[model samples]
Target chain A: MDSLGLYVLAAAVLFGVGVYGLIVSEHLMRKLFAINIMGNAIFILLVAASGPVEGAPDPVPQALVLTGIVIAVSATAFALALMVRLYQETGQATLSSRDEGDDG
Target chain B: MTAEALALIVFLPLLAACAAVAFPGRWLGWIVRIGLLPLPVLMLAPTLAVLDQNVIHLALAGHASPLGIEWRLDPLSLLMLWLNVGITVLISLHAGVSFRPDSDRGQRFWPLWLILFASMNALVLSADLFNLYVTLELVTLAAIGLIAVESKPAALRAGMRYLLLALMASLLYLLGVGLIYGQTGTLDLYLIAEQIEPGWLPVTAMALMIVGLLIKSAVFPLHAWLPAAHGNAPGPVSAILSAMVVKVSIYMIWRLWFWGAAGWDLATAANLMGLLGAAAIVYGSLAALVQDRLKMIVAYSTVAQLGYLMLLFPLASTLAFQAASYHLLSHGLAKAAMFLAAANILSSVGTDRLQRLAGVDQRRPLDVFALALGGVSILGLPPSGGFVAKWLFLEAAWHQQAWGWLVLVAAGGLLAAAYLFRVLGVICLHPRKRLNRRQHREIPNLASVAALILAVSAIAAGFFSAPVLSLISAGLPPGVTP
Candidate 1:
């Protein structure tokens, strides 16, 4: 396969994996990890696809992807904290409100 | 002066947030509150000056050719910036007084909030694609942190779920950016539009990007993370998340569709969006109707309000686009007011359940007024900006002969009204609860004032629609008549 084709396939695989993780993972933290990995995969695809403009990966998308990475991690960290809080207060990880005496 | 002012608009909060870390305990909350004061003034002054001017582009970092970042200001941006700063100030004010000095995780809240403000400013000001992505990430991170702060188990789990979804969305968006770069070899949106061919690559990139952003915007099927995350967050945090954070992703969606990939046939996409929007309107309203909790009802109401955004794609005209922007601004005001009113009721009852809020209006006249005003705005009743926005949106849809989209728009407003008044009905009914003396802490003056400002803005913005609409039309593309 051509380099572009190879990159596309890889991106597809990563996206698939991310989706799988989202579906399969029950723990909030694990789900976050899967999500971050998925994000990294996309960032790789973006940088790879924009290959070697002026003998360099295009700086603009790179900067954007970098920013995206930081955001991904920050959000992950925050969510982890929230998950821990949820576990401590309510002793559950699922999102349904039924257990808290909430109807619907 | 402009550069300094713009820089101050973004960085002052960042600096103060960082400085607040070492601040003494007794003053920590106050310090955080003080840190957010300058931004609204900074943004407000420029907005007035740029009232007639359409596009204000500021070049920064001065390195030529794709290296430097550009800050573009437009009426849409100014409105967003003002709301971000204004709402943050009010949220901070409420947080300062309502939170116990010793409670809430010390100085952390202010820093994250300031960072969120900075990122929001950057998101609105951003001129190019990369900057938009970066700013979006910043917003997501800060928002997640805010959600997790409750330190309750559910908050942690919900926050984590939100984070995961956000990460997935960001990754997907990045992948799309990569494809666009490969095809065009440029990151500047304007430059990309010039070089991009009408071909498979750009189309693929657009699809991927839309999917990613749809998740972030919490549009329909991808919106699983929002209701829980927004509902579970602290009151002020919920206000900010609902009022402005989600709108940033929607703004980026607009930037991409309108400016970057302007010529792509959006008919199918528009119809799909319209369908999902319709579903969200009905589903969100039905969901809100059944929600026993106040915040969840409001959170679902957000889903319905968000459906209004999709109307732009179907009715893609200057008028339609202007109406969408109007709805965005109006919804920001009304939703913020709604959340603040909900916060007031929660404080009064030590809970946010609707049934518990019985007799609340009778007991707290201020909260009653706030809820009533907020309800009127959300329902798109007369003299409110929500009404003006719906009127304009309906007008544009009627002009296009897009009858299906028109019906959905009207139906969404009615759904919004149904949900908004459902809670109002509870308050007005005066159910069987005696007010516990201990639960009554005087609602902070700032929260009420903040809600009032937004409520007034929602009503007053109708009068200024002509100017704002004109501002949005500046430099827009004209019809390509043969």
Candidate 2:
């Protein structure tokens, strides 16, 4: 396979790993990491999939990647803060152990 | 002039959000007012322009598509703009009461609220797929933040689950955007629609994006997070989340299916989507019937109400388009009213437990009235916006001679009626001893009045259907025959 095809395959593998981690890990922090990994995978695919324009990498995908990175980072930061707050409130960082009748 | 106005519609609330953060306390109220009050007046220019031109496209910063971002305003988008403005401004009245600007909760709530508002306006107007993803993220983040703003353990947990799912969904959507961009080399939705062939890659991309949107919109089987999140949020927050937040993703799905993928033969996939809608209507209503809490019922109703929109894909005609778009408007107003009313009831009566809410109508007549009025629309009764929309849906189905879809429409409305009447029966008909004066806390009239206005307008929407229906028909999607 060519180098571009190899990168696309790698991104796909990474995305699968991220989805696996997101499902298996109970910790909110781990889930956040999994989400970021998935985001990174998409970024790689975004940049890899677009062909070069006149021998230069496509500028639009690069710009899109940069924006995607900013969004992923901010979302991660917010998720981390939420996890901490959740831990403080419930004394548990995982969603599974919450009290069933506590919904109000 | 129209371009500047369009820009202002998005940026005004965003600017208010920044200003809200800088000056967090006493000035927040005035900031929100200044931010939102001019929106309707500003929307007039675009409204007129769309009416005259059928569709108006603005290339941001004077660069054309395939390079610069584009914003399109057609009848559907114009309707969305009006709904966002009307609902947000009215709901703000309730928020202003519940989350006082001088209070700490208000300080956090207003900024996120403004940001969500701006992002939604941008989302509806966006002509680029990547831009839609960004705006969807912004809307999701801001909305989840609002959900957890109260920091109740339940709200926080709900927010966390929603955040995780929303993040995953955005990534899926982004992957699809990447694939589409790779193939078409243009991010513009119209350009992609024009250039895309009915091939494996493009079909896969469309499937990925639609599934991502389905999750975001909380269609059946993907809607587990909705009840807790919408149920636990503060009154105004829940109102907006149910009314517009979820609807925006569905709107994106509509844009993609009818406009972006116009040329593709999606008959099988459309049937699959319709089946999901049928499932959601059945499952959501049945789940809602058993929910003990009032807010959860309303939240589940949102899940069910969203089903009507999916029917459009299968019915795929101008009538179906009109029906679905009209459903969006009516359901948005009704659902917001219901949430706001439920919030008031919960705050006043100290709980929304269906069993505990007996005789609530005696003390909080306005709120109960608002809730029932909103329920009338949800159940698609006459002289309500929902009734008009449901009639259109049935007519669309009848025209297509799709008996199963026609049955589903009828059954959905009946199921809606069943759950709605269940709530009304408990609140209005249950016998209870006279409550002690101390048992009920007095909520402000303004909160109840705000909900009443929304409910009344939902009913009012049925009266003004002709103009809106004609406008919707004026800009039908490419493949549909008007």
Candidate 3:
């Protein structure tokens, strides 16, 4: 496979793992990590869509990747803050509503 | 003038966000009010010249449409903007009094709220896919943060779950954007729409985008996140969350399929969505009727109201579009009024439980009036916005002879009335407060006034349908004209 195909496949794998973790993981921190993985996967896929450039890389996807990374970082940091605060207040790392089984 | 007014409308909210933090905590609440002073000038300016040929494209930073970021202001955007701004202003007015700047939640709430407003305003005006992704993320983060503002365990848990689901939705949406970009080499929605041929990639992208929007909008089967998040948030927070945030994705989905691209005969697809909507209306109303907490009831009703909008998908027509827009306005105002009033009652009485609520009307007459008036609209009573909108929907369905949809519309309205009257019945059965009557006096608060204004406006919407319809018609998006 070409490098572009490899990148796309890697993104797909990362995205699958992230979605799986996001849904199945009980802990909030793991979920946040899953979100990060998913975010990275999207970034990879976006960069891949930009195609390979030997002389000069496409600026559009590069610019988008930079902005996406910033947004992801800020979102991750905020989620982490929330996770820590929830753990402190309730002494539990998982969400209570899930344990309550109200989702059923 | 329209361009300047629109630009300021988007940016002034960002200014409010900064002022929320820059000013001293004591001054923050009132100071943000001062920042809102610029929006009223849009009222003074003449109406925007929306389109020459079904689109009024504006380029930012002196760049033209093909290269620089582009924005479009069609009727849908204009209508959404007007509704969004009206709700934001009312809620902000309520917030200034309800959340004292010195309060813990208030200090964190104002900045995020103003930023959410800016993001939503930008999202509606945006004409491109990549820009929409950024604004959507901003909106989701601000909304999640608002949900967690209370920092209580339930609120935190709700907020975390909301964040997870919203992130998932955004990823799905972004993947669609990626697919479209890979195929079309452009992120501008109109350009992408033009280049989109009925192929595997285009079809897959459309499906992904629609699924993402459905989840985010909490339409039916994907609706579990909404009740918990909206129900758990603080009052004005829930008001905007229920009224505006959920609508944005659905609005975008509408723009994509019906107006922008995906012009192929998705007749079966539209009918399927209509079926899901029917389920949402029935299930959501039943769920709302059984909800113990008042906010939970309102939140579930939001799911049902969203379903009402989805019916427009199957019955796509000028009348149906107009009906959906009117209903959206009607529901936004009425629901905001109800949630704000519920907040007043919950805070004053210390419980949102139906059995515990007694003499709330006596304590807060204006707030009760707000709830009742809002209930009237939700129930689709005459001389209210909901009634007019539903009537139009019924007429549209009948004209198309979509008999199933006609039945769903009638049944849904009846179910809405049933659930709404349940709350009204409870209110009328007001028991004497545990506290002495003299101890519980109605203290004046702007929240009640905000609620009252929204309630009055929802009723007023029924009368001004002609003008609103005309305004909406002015900026209708171009039909598929290859």
lDDT (tens digit, per residue) of candidate 3 on A10-41: 99999999989988988888888888999899
Please identify model 3 stretches exceeding 4 Å from their true place. A53-57, A98-104, B43-46, B51-55, B65-67, B430-443, B480-482
What is the number of backbone collisions in each predicted candidate, taken in the order shown? 14, 0, 0
Q: What is the lDDT of residue B238 in candidate 2?
A: 95
- Worst-scoring 10-residue span by lDDT in model 3 chain B: B43-52
Query: What is the C-alpha local distance difference test score of each model?
Result: 0.75, 0.91, 0.82
Which lDDT tens digits does candidate 1 get at residues B1-482? Answer: 66678878887877767766666466766566556776766775567656746667788766544678888787667777877887777666666655544555645566777778888988888887777777888888889888776565555556766777777777777777777877876777656777886688788888888888989989887888888888877777888898899988988887787678777677888788778878877888888889889988888889888988887876778778777888887788778877777777777677888777777876676766866786677778888878888888888878878888788878877887787777778777754657677777676677666666666777777777777677666635333111
What is the C-alpha lDDT profile of model 2 across A1-104, one tens digit per residue?
98788889999899999999999998888888888999999998988776563587778898999999999989998999998998888889999635433546
- How many Å off is the CA of B146 in candidate 3? 1.3
DockQ of each: 0.50, 0.70, 0.49
- Whichever of 1 and 3 has more DockQ, that candidate is 1
Model 2: number of clashes? 0
Candidate 3's docking class is acceptable
Model 1 stretches with alpha carbons more than 4 Å out = A2-8, A50-104, B24-34, B48-53, B100-106, B431-442, B475-482
Candidate 1: Cα lDDT at A52: 69
On residues B1-482, what C-alpha lDDT tens digit does candidate 3 reach at each position? 76677777888888878888887578886667765656665633423465334446678766864447788877678788888888988887777767667787788888888899889989998998888888988999999998888776777888887888888888888888878877887888877767877788888998888898899999999998999888878888999998999999889888888655646778888889998889999999999999878888888999998998899788888788888889999999999999999888777766677655556667777888999999889878899998889898898888888888889889988888888788877776755545444445353488799999999999999998997887666655556221
DockQ of 1: 0.50
